[model samples]
Structure formats: C-alpha cells, structure tokens
Target: MTKLIGYARVSTKAQDADRQIQDLLAAGVRRDDLYTDHGLSGALAKRPALDKALTALHPGDTLVITTLDRLGRSTQKMLELAEELRDRNIGLRVLNLGGGDVDTKTPMGAMVFTVMAALAQMELEIKRERINDSVTKRRATGGDLGGRRPTFTESQIRTASKLIKAGEPATQVAKDMGMSHATLYRRIKKLP
Candidate 1:
C-alpha cells in the first residue's frame, strides 16, 4: 500500500517545529509518518529525522513538506532531489509553493516545480551580479575598506603598468607581483 511521509525542519531552537507538524498533520499525514529536524539547519550534512523519513519511502510513496525550502535552500539541490524522487517512482509534494501546493505526481505541478527552480536560479544569479557590482563600485570609490588590501602599492602599479605596456605578459607580472592576472590588467587600465 502507498503511504504519505512528511518531513519538517526549523533551523533554530527558538523556532517552533509544531507549526510544521501541524501543517503536515492537516495535510493528511499520519502522526507516525512525520519526521522533524528541530533546531537543525537544512545545510547540515546529517539530519537523522530526514534520513529516516527518506529511508521509509518506497516506490509508490510520497514525500511531503510545507515548502520546497524545507527540503533545502539550494535550488539546485532541491531540483536534483525532486528529479531523483521522480526517477525512483516516488512523489514529492510541497504544500505551499507560490500560494498553492505542488505534487510531482501531477503534470501541472511538475511543470510549476521546474519553472520555479528556473526562476530561483535566475534570482540567485541576479543577486550575485548586483552584489559584485556593488562591491566593485565601493572599491573604486574607496568606500569599502573592509575587503583585503590591494596587494600592489602605487610604485608597484606604476612598474607593472610600464612592464605590461612594454610587452611583458600580464600573467607573469601578476605572478611576480603576487596579484592576479585580472588585477594586473585592471591596474594597467587605470594608468593615465
């Protein structure tokens, strides 16, 4: 017979695991079918409850969570796990994904799951690019002094610029100066 297995996680001791347990119960998971990782981070390599929950699933069983993030914060890892579950002929159900539930057993739910993963990946890349741009601007304006100091002093920059202009390889200059090739090129570009 097919069974429904539920897993819940809360990252901190202050957070209430009962809320997720209640949600899972309301979704029709039996009390004994629920597994929880209280005060444990999803990033942790070992989650004994989650390990047990997964091991209990069979080919026709379904794994349920309140949110996709309950499984993991990493979109890539969640996608991989969802794919693996599908391959094993097990189902995955997220109770609240974008104001609704997603069950891999349904065609529309599967499509939404894939689309959401793509959207998540795009958001992460956009956030990374924005952060990189912000740091670059701060560094250029000398406003972010918290980062590592520039390895090359003014005199070294001048020498590096002249060497590069005189046909010395930027990589060799970077190696000799204890900086990166990209840094050497950027410093060369800054010369008047």
Candidate 2:
C-alpha cells in the first residue's frame, strides 16, 4: 500500500513541531505515520526520526514536509536527499515551498525542483569563489583575515614551544597550556 509519511523537525528545544504536524495531517497524512525530530538542528547530518521515516517508506510512498528547511537547510544535502528519494521511487511534497504547490510526483513539479537545485548549487559556488578571492586579496595587502584569537598568550606559547623543542610530548605540552594537542600543532605551523 502506498502511504503518505510526514517528517518534521525543529532546530531547538524551545521551538514546537505542532504547526508542521498540523500541516501534514491536513495534507492527508495519518497521525501515526508522522515522524518528528525535536531540538535537532538541520545542519546536523544525523537525524534519528528522519532515518526511521526514510526506512519506513516503500516504493510509491510519498514523503511530506511542511517546508524545505524542515527537511534540510543545506542545499547540497537537500539535493542529495532528493536524488536518493527519486532513485528509491519515493515522492516528495513541500507544503510551503514558494508559498504554493511543490510536489515532485508530477512532471512540472520535478522540473521546478531540478531548476531550483541547480540555481542554488551555482549560487553557493559563486559565493565560495568570491570569499576565496577576497581572502587572497586581503592577505596580499597585509589585512588580517582574522579567525579565532589564540587562546594562549605569547609567554605561554614560548614556554610550550621550548617544552616541545626539549623533546616533551605534544599532548603533555598542550595539556599544560590548557589547549588541545591538535591546537598546539596548528599554532606551531603558523609560526614564522
């Protein structure tokens, strides 16, 4: 039997999934067929409820979500999931996409999703190129593309370096300086 399964997610504990649930129910999904992930950020790759929902879906089943972001905020991840769903013969419907119908089961709907995904991927690539160029230009002009400030002061860094040079273990030096061993190595790499 082809079932209409719904998946909902909220980014934080304070947020509610009721609205999404209501929307899914209104779209003819059975209450028992609804899956929810609470207090889970869309940026996280692992989602237990979403996994269960996907596993429960069989070929010809429809997967529904209130919004595209509820499914995933990352364009690449969303596109990958869409391709997986397509390959598995599961349909997708987003109730709030473009404030209108966005169902992948129909030919027009599939075309719209394909176009949107392509545009999103292109936009991300362009943004990445701009950032890389800006960083390069800034470095050439001695402008600091500042990152997280060093947790250790100059005196501490000097002490740690001396200890490392004296054959003390990196892990021990980092522990003494209240930083991770990886951080100690990264700091050494930055030294002229």
lDDT of 2 at 61: 95
Angstrom error at residue 79, model 2: 1.2
Candidate of highest lDDT: 2
- Write down the lDDT that model 1 would get: 0.86
Please, what is the TM-score per model? Answer: 0.62, 0.61
Q: Candidate 1 residues 76-106, lDDT tens each?
A: 7778888889998999998888998899988
Off by over 4 Å in 1: 120-192
Every candidate's CA RMSD: 11.8, 7.0
> Best candidate, TM-score-wise?
1
- What lDDT, from 0 to 1, does candidate 2 have? 0.86
